[model samples]
Target: MNWMDSLFHELQTIPEVAGLAAADDTGTYIAGMNIDDTDEFAALLTFIGRSGLALEEHLGLDPLVYTSLSGKKIKLIVHRILDYFVGIRLSEKSSISKVEGRINSIVGNLDIEDE
Candidate 1:
């Protein structure tokens, strides 16, 4: 599978993680909220860096950047990490509407190039 698809599939293994990979309004809200938490944000950055390093090692790349195919994989992994964090924050129904609205606005402008 392509990197994005593989990353998405792996994310689906965790309930919280899966919700984020949906990339819908709900998912975006969860991601946004997760990033707002200092501890969660730090953990997320660490996870992304580790995932990126793994991908780079597997692909035998000397340097990683988002434009590179391996780097794209890293980017997707980071996105999912953010989503997972947001999903945890969204466990409460009370935050759903506001989170969904914010996520919708943010993701709406994102240009997801066709894979």
Candidate 2:
């Protein structure tokens, strides 16, 4: 498999992780795993990130860097890296701090890097 695929695999090895997805700054899909309707989901994630930034700008707060959405079944963790985004899906029972730590490492390893 390619490096991107390998990265996705590595991210999933984290306990309680259910899926992973990457999207461009514009919300276009880059890569993903274990997600049905990947494109739609990626686009939705992009919108959420963009909206968060808008909220930050409107409120004159620090630059928004991360986001989290949780449900009874799953939780979505999103990281913004300049013009790109990475999202990790985790089980509701998972420790968010643990998952975020794993995602931070994976995001650091991504070639895109954050600006």
Candidate 3:
């Protein structure tokens, strides 16, 4: 399988990851699972990712690695990979630190631009 496919599969293997979706710079749904409205989700992910990048630029901070959002029922972790935005949805009880570390290890070992 391709790297993106492998990445998605690995992310889903995490027990707490309920679903994941990816979006391009244009906010188009590229891939995912268990997502109710992929188009909308893609748009949202793109918007949030771009906003984070812009915020970091405006503040003269380092590039944004990821962002997390926690709501009443679920938690979402969004990663900006080149021109793509990947959103990983987690169960409320999931350990964000552990998951993020795992994700970091998986992604760090691969050449993201090769995908």
Candidate 4:
């Protein structure tokens, strides 16, 4: 399997995840499923996640890891991977910790095209 495939596969195992997408820093979709507009959504998600950097600094939380947004029906998560960002959409009812650990395990091993 491709590097992205490994990441996506692990993400898929998460009980709550309904969609997954990986986008380069430039916001190009690399892999995913069920997202309405991968390109646009990736860009938006990238911006949102990166933006948290400033927020983290403001809040004095060093070393940003990931960011999650919970809505009434869904939970969205984004992680900054070297030169890309991974977006996951899941059912709000599920526990994020279950998938978070899996994600962390696979991210460092991902063999992407660039970096």
TM-score of each: 0.28, 0.78, 0.89, 0.74
* 20-107: candidate 3 lDDT, tens digit per residue: 9999989999989999999999998999899998999999999899888887876888888767899988888887877888877776
For all candidates, the clash counts are 1, 0, 0, 0
Q: Give one digit per residue, the lDDT tens place, for model 2 in 1-115.
A: 2555656777877878888888988778988888888898899789889889999999999988789887786688888865667788887788787678777788677674322
Which prediction has the highest TM-score against the true structure?
3
Model 2 quality (TM-score)? 0.78
RMSD to native for every prediction?
14.0, 3.1, 1.7, 3.0
Candidate 4 lDDT for residue 113: 64
The RMSD (Cα, Å) of candidate 4 is 3.0
How would you encode candidate 4's per-residue C-alpha lDDT over 3-51 as one tens digit per residue?
6677888778767788888877676777788888878888877787778
State the lDDT of candidate 1 residue by residue for 7-97, as single tens digits: 4344344333213322322223222222334444445544555566578899998754321112321212232322232222223222333
Off by over 4 Å in 1: 1-35, 66-115
Cα deviation of 96 in candidate 2 (Å)? 1.8
**C-alpha lDDT of residue 14 in model 3:** 80
Q: lDDT (CA) for every model shown? A: 0.36, 0.80, 0.85, 0.77
TM-score winner between candidates 2 and 3: 3
Q: Which ten residues in a row have the lowest lDDT in candidate 1?
A: 66-75
Better of 1 and 3 by lDDT: 3
How do all the candidates rank in terms of lDDT, highest first? 3, 2, 4, 1
Task: Give me the candidate number with maximum lDDT.
Answer: 3
- Candidate 2 Cα errors over 4 Å, as ranges: 1-7, 109-115
For model 2, state the Cα shift of residue 72 in Å: 1.5
